[model samples]
Target: MPQSETLRAQAAPPRLRWWTELPLILLVYACYSAGRLLARDDVTTAVDHGLAILRIEKSLHLNAEHPLNRLFTQEAWLGVPADFWYASLHYLITPALLVWLFRSRAVRYRAARTWLMTSTFLGLIGFTLLPTCPPRLLDAGHGFVDTMAQYSAYGWWGGEASAPRGMGNLTNQYAAMPSLHVGWALWCGVMLWRFGGTRLAKTAGVVYPLVTTIVVMGTANHYFLDAAAGAAVMGVGLLLTPLMLRAADRVRGSFALRSGRSPEASPVRSPQVSKGPRASIVSGGCQTSAGERFPRQRESALPTGAGPDASPADTGDGAPAAAR
Candidate 1:
């Protein structure tokens, strides 16, 4: 039968093609959102992700007075409008990326979403647990001052605690431990490098990662350590990605197995019946296979030497009777 007719023979079919991972994605999203909300509830909040970083930072004496720290800790000499660049970037870039992905392939879209969200979620958890304030939030004269908050020009939203939390706030604020800004930007670069447009895409693939790392550290959104942690998270996330999809596939296959069903066992072939010569008995030996078998003696019209007990006539008579 034709393939078209064979497809029609199915009693039921999958409603969505390769949608097995959707449920798991949704579940992860729910847990992540809940964790973000818990930051407000100090008692239940898991703020270690960020606190852990702060503890290490203090141990290494890399606070405000540290030379590398002071570079980023210093007020933005480029002017306060830089916050406009930073704040606007966080708001606009990811969503725009996601939108572009919606028009692209589903695997890439999902992968991008996973990388972005996972990085953000881990950052948020750090924020709640660690809560190391940004340089701008520092009150001491030596520590970094909250330039965006202090400079009202384009940093209107900087340090504005009153902004209502929404579904968009799936990440934490004070968890600058592992800056998702840097991590997610790197994720974008990786996605583009792995699956982007053209020559320019390839160039961006090379440049974006380095540029993003510099921006985050120079701007004080992340420290060198923070950027390193972000990259680590991305690496781990990408490595575990195959496990997620494979797990979903196995679940479906398990269900099929339970019902004594599987990819139709390649139709069993019937054993072919041979139509060759039949076996025959020979002097002192027998044949039971395909090829003809002969005894260890030569054939002759007359016996080469008749036994003492039997004459040539007797042997001839015996051969004629056997032939019969």
Candidate 2:
């Protein structure tokens, strides 16, 4: 193969294995959670950032959080379901879609997985750089209600965040500059639309992200600008995916080299011919000629003083005796 073809083959997406993929997904999630925790800045700073975003949105007339939040809060029917969607679907749907792609559409799984993970890490970076508080976490005067808190009795989450009743402290509420919920929903949407091959899946691809955007806003978990930034992050990640896959291939290749093997190396060795002479015996007591040619057999010198008609000693069954 040409050098370019060899590199392309090496860089192709590897076969999926649940044993390896599960651990990797868990590790990335853990890192994302830890990053959110570590990026928790002081409440005063976070509030200031939130207010600045609010001012910018107001200037641009994009302050959709307040009205949607009011609508969710005023109606129990909408509030409860939106709260559940915000807390549960973000965790459930993304992984379910990933498994779907891994099992049913494996050819596209690696690139899709890489895109999601890259966007998630980029969101983490945004959190670390700008720890803006969610609209619900703002002062009561801001007119934003935390639907999750209001509908706490209807679900398993507590007032602090989407985490379970007592585990809210484990999560960072201030890391809301870029909403991963929206980004992940967009990822799932794209995956479903591109590879689903069904009418229902395609419809879901359109509805899931659109509804997720509304849910995040209505629940006051993210600002309009934060959702926009989430989308931008996904865009950047998509653009970087090819480079990321290439880098991963390089790393894997380096490890293979360290382990004393090349991925393209063949395991079978070539056949070798022996230089020593080989012995042959004629069947039915037939005697061999002095200078007969045999395939791949080197001629041997006859014993000293042996006549041309001399025959080698034979064992039973017409076998030739071993040379002394």
On TM-score, the leading prediction is: 2
- For 202-240, candidate 1 gives per-residue lDDT tens digits of 787677677666555555555667777778877776776
| TM-score for each model | 0.56, 0.79
Model 2 C-alpha lDDT versus the unseen true structure = 0.83
The TM-score measured for candidate 2 stands at 0.79
Q: Per-prediction count of colliding residue pairs?
A: 11, 0
lDDT of model 2, residue 157: 90
Candidate 1 stretches with Cα past 4 Å from truth are 1-34, 40-81, 110-112, 115-129, 155-158, 161-172, 252-324
Misplaced by over 4 Å in model 2 are 1-12, 264-324
Error of 1 at 23 (Å): 9.9
Worst 10 residues of 1 by lDDT: 315-324
